[model samples]
Target: INIIIQNQTMIAQMPHAADLNDVMSAIEAMRIQEESSYQCPDYLSKSEEDGSALPVNEECRRKMAEWCYQVVDYCKFSRETVAIAMSLIDRYLASNQGREALANRKLFQLAAMTSLYSAVKVHEPEAMEPKTIAGLSRGAYNEDQVTAMELEVLGAIGWRMNPPTPLAFVHHCLALLPDGSMSMSDREAILEIAKFQTELAVHDYSFVHIDASKIALAAV
Candidate 1:
């Protein structure tokens, strides 16, 4: 299912992936990824099974990511939005000051919702609004709260919004293989499997700090 199925108008249009790929050189793509790769969240210092080191446990974080997935699926927003949102959440929570904030579950959920809101607002602006995101919280939060959290989260991440994604890395790596190396049918099958690994990495918290390039390489 395509995450974005917009009704285009004369004012603007979504460029096809092919249209975009044609303009960008692979060297430039890798360079951009190199610049942005440091923006990824730190390896979670604590785990659920371990004696507590941080208030934000891994399971809770995992659940938050899943909820984001559910919301994006319902809204027909790109599933990649969840990855982006979770990246924001993780980067924020991994901070010294933010460590205390994660101790509060309500604040965490509000932050979670806000992160999702921020992602959709950035990537799928027409799909949702802060008011709608607040409503989805079942009255636990209001529009003001969501908006504030969005600002706070963005501030926490130093306004570096374009985090590298595993899928993007996968695409670049796949393109490196010569077309003659594999039959079209076999190439398609391999691509599907490789893409699936990237999806799994996106959902699994252990993969958070791993480089997107590393994940992509492992996937293939």
Candidate 2:
């Protein structure tokens, strides 16, 4: 928990009216935007073992997601980056289903890496370049290929990079709790638990379509 908590010095801050208002506004916006653009493809429509129609089936999706998590973990980026990257991949795939351009495994890998690169660029303070991502690909992809795929993914998703992730909802919901309702340490403990659940949820394709707010509340 401490490792990921960022600031270990817990300065207990009380929730104010403006703070609550901002959260409420953000939550409402997230709910609206979620339905409008962020909803992922249905897990119920999972392809068969052979991945007949789509090369990027649920198994492939989970593997990519897990790989994203590994990259963020190794790079010490927020675990939420994995959630955001996965969301980008999902929303792009949802927009273009079974398209021949994305029907190849090699192309799928490019899309996955480019999604992670784009997410990091948008959300992380230290942005990762296409070449860095290419190096991580271990010669499977080159910088130019990654650069091209980044543009394709960005355009596919309408450049809406910041989707409300489960972790974001978790933090916002936790803020809504009455101040001093519990010891800061206890609150941190609960957060640690919920964070673990959300991270696991990100890896499982089953939860991709489920609303992030619902998943966050359930995890809490």
Instruction: Indicate which candidate wins on lDDT.
Output: 2
For model 1, the stretches where C-alpha displacement exceeds 4 angstroms are 1-37, 41-43, 46-53, 125-127
Q: What are the TM-scores, per candidate, against the unseen true structure?
A: 0.78, 0.85
Candidate 2 regions with alpha-carbon error over 4 angstroms: 1-18, 43-52
lDDT for each residue of candidate 2 in 8-90, tens digit (9 for 90 to 100):
22111223434788878877888888777787767336444336466566688788888988898899978888888988887
Error of 2 at 194 (Å): 0.8
TM-score computed on alpha carbons, candidate 1: 0.78
| Best candidate, TM-score | 2
Model 1 lDDT per residue over 69-136, tens place: 88878877677777777877877877654665667888888888887777666666464667787789
Question: Which consecutive 10 residues in model 2 have the weakest lDDT in total?
Answer: 1-10
Please give the lDDT score at residue 51 for candidate 1: 46
TM-score, model 2 to reference? 0.85
